[model samples]
Target: MVLHDLRKYSFWGLLSLAINLMYTKIIFPCALLVRRPAHIRILGSYSIGRGFTSGPGLILDVLNDNAELLIGSNVKLNHRCHIGVMKSVKIGNDVLFASNVFISDHTHGSYIGDMQSNPLQPPNEREIVCGNVEIGDKVWIGENVAVLLGVSIGESSIIGANSVVTKDIPAFSIAVGSPARVIKTWDKAVEKWVAVS
Candidate 1:
């Protein structure tokens, strides 16, 4: 652990940290910290509150001028987390995201709408269908999780690793698995998480 810490805090690491400080203060004044080497392409707008920090390789993409992404204060996102917004994505305060997590508010083509994109067309060339995603405060999203379009993750919830959240997760719950389901919910009186029976 000590050796790993030393390697992580090496000269290049320190330089990256310094550059991030400048980037936050000057370039992106909304965020308190954004680690360097992040692939951020925001044609739209985003507002991140103070004490927002992200690890290296954080990818934030806002595809169009109408898109908006809002993140509250003291949110921490680990390495390689990607958030792609086409309409709106609001993340509340004190949220945590583990590595390789993806949160997107849009998909390549419309499946439910009448004006669907051509199936013969490439996905990259297809029209984008927009949605909205809202993540409440004090939510802990585990590694490799994908929070899909039009989903809402309520406050004080935990999403297990490798899960794909396709629907709304109620507050004070523990959800897991692909197409994530609420496996347990917090019982305040018992002060424990009781399994969904």
Candidate 2:
């Protein structure tokens, strides 16, 4: 009886191992092809399902419980995007995100660092801030854009490269500078967009 149980467990273990290997090499690359030019920022692509749809490489952390959302069908995510997906963050379709884009939903569980001093040392945690971050369809997020928590960017808007977004921005608006102020909006009547002129 013990021999039979061992065999069964070994079979299960091998199956799981095969499955993991398949996703890392085969399934993931195929998904990326579905959306050409798009890349993924992963939270836990191996075990957890936090990753992109059809794109390039992604980075995610399992211990932190951070999730990654796909930008669009075809997007490119450069390296070093610190996405805090402990909460919910959604990106729309046909968007382009530059390198070092911070799409975080939660700033560490506490205000102070969560990393302990030593293996046995206690932790110091403060209030948690978890909110939803949504980027609209066909939006462009520039490099070094620090998107704060609980902010929603409307559809068809252009976010200038290296801008800081603090509050919610309306659709078809051109926001730039620190704290990302809405300089103008897209005017279909004039066939041209207007900023705060």
Candidate 3:
């Protein structure tokens, strides 16, 4: 009875290991929206590096052939994170994104006129305004953050929760608020982060 139990345990362990390997190697590479190792949905194109991990409900949408979404190694994207790339979006290595973060490099229609006037025309049919978004290495983006078009986030920066990033964030800085102001920056001389006076 002891020997039979040992064999059963070993067989189950091997089966689990095989499933994990298949999910990581075969399924993840082919799937567009990956909910888990086994569950995935087709959506967009991704140029991802090694050791990329994402939680449930990640949306990656590449609009056209010119659109490119490049994610570097060891990046972790938490639940319900949406990344829409109409032009280009380059994310560097070791980046951590919390839940409900939205990053988009394009906007629907030109900022010329109000859309309420034309009720018949669908918004999706309008022209898209696109730009490139570049995020450097070791950046941590908190929950409910929205990163807009043409923004460049420098290395080792921290984006606070519920912030809207409309402009560039400098390296080693902590930014917060609606426009995402730089509230603090890492002072290399002091070996710590200092508040902006």
Assess each prediction's global lDDT (C-alpha) against the native.
0.91, 0.62, 0.82
User: Candidate 2 on 161-194: residue-level lDDT in tens?
Assistant: 8898878999988898788999989999997887
Q: By TM-score, is 1 or 2 better?
A: 1
Q: Over the stretch 17-112, how does candidate 1's per-residue lDDT look in tens digits?
A: 678888878756767677767898889998888788898899999988989999999999999999999999999999999999999998898877
- Score candidate 2 by TM-score against the native: 0.63
Report the C-alpha displacement of residue 80, candidate 1, in angstroms: 0.7
Q: Which residue pairs collide, candidate 3?
A: none
Using lDDT as the measure, name the better of candidate 1 and candidate 3. Answer: 1
Alpha carbon lDDT at 193, candidate 2:
81
TM-score for candidate 3, please give it: 0.79
Of the pair 1 and 2, which is ahead by lDDT? 1
Q: Rank the candidates by lDDT, best first.
A: 1, 3, 2
Error of 2 at 120 (Å): 20
Model 3 spans > 4 angstroms off = 1-21, 29-34, 37-45, 112-121
> Which has the greatest lDDT?
1
Query: How far off is residue 55 in model 3, in Å?
Result: 0.5
Q: In model 1, where do residues sit more than 4 Å from their true spots?
A: 1-8, 112-118
lDDT of 1: 0.91
